[model samples]
Target: MKSTHVLILLGLLAACKSQPKEKETEAPANAPKAEPIACYQYATAADTITLKLVNMGGTVGGALIYKLKEKDMNAGTIKGTLRGDILLADYTFKSEGTQSTRQVAFKKTGNAFIEGYGETTNVNGVEQFKNADSIVYSSSMKLEEIPCK
Candidate 1:
């Protein structure tokens, strides 16, 4: 009886060990990867740059071009370089008599269109008093094509 009990226990242990655990599966081979609907890298021709900071408004409508690192029109975070023309679109203003330049880091999201948001001091400069500012910018940039080149 003792020997039989030992054999049964061993058999149960072996059976439990032999059973396979579930394995992780990869997505289907035909699964589609997300691609941008449209994207553009600013070249020599600078687009119309506009800003509405507090009661101040400025538009640097000139040859202000930008570079594209990895901006996906469909992605939530659209980031890259924001330099070309001037050192920066700087300013100084105040509601109660304090002034500072704007500074901001832009991120875009949406469909064929993208909306950007960041500190005024991020894009502008230190004189904008960005700590007291919360802003979102709507891109007038027309979605053309995301060049793979």
Candidate 2:
């Protein structure tokens, strides 16, 4: 009788045991996808600026092309860290046949990136400007987002 009771108790305990959870092998089919990268361009009489950036959260990284007549035409890369609505990055490019680097910032409004206020970067004794504004975009020469093909 005692042996039978012990076996019954063991059987009851085993029946009440919880099963191990199964791990997820893959993401759900209905999971949302990430946003695609965006491209922007700014044109003026003196310069033309183009940027192809991918924003992950608030951080930005992409290609930047800046060209200014008699100043510099640079095709460099940008790695931006966000502060407020501004994306600040160090721009390194080949300017006037010479390589140089500088600090540049942009402010995002809607789908546009207006100049946030660039001081000056010395690139072989030359300076590059896409707009006349010392700290922000003026009435003209704004950086607007362009559709990618």
Model 2 regions lying over 4 Å from their true place: 1-35, 44-46, 56-58, 118-139
- Give TM-scores for every candidate, taking all chains together and pairing residue i with residue i: 0.23, 0.57
State the lDDT of candidate 1 residue by residue for 1-149, as single tens digits: 99999999999998888667688586566754333323433233533222221111132211112333443111112222233311133333332344443333323333222234555434433433254235454555533324433
Query: Which candidate's TM-score is highest?
Result: 2
Query: Distance (Å) between predicted and true CA of 45, model 1?
Result: 8.8
lDDT of 2 by residue, 2-27 (tens): 99999999999999999998998776
Candidate 2 colliding pairs, count: 1
- Per-prediction CA RMSD (Å): 15.1, 10.2
Superposition-based RMSD of candidate 1 using all C-alpha atoms, in angstroms: 15.1
Per-prediction backbone clash count: 20, 1
Alpha carbon lDDT of each predicted model: 0.35, 0.72
Candidate 2 — worst ten consecutive residues by lDDT sum? 125-134
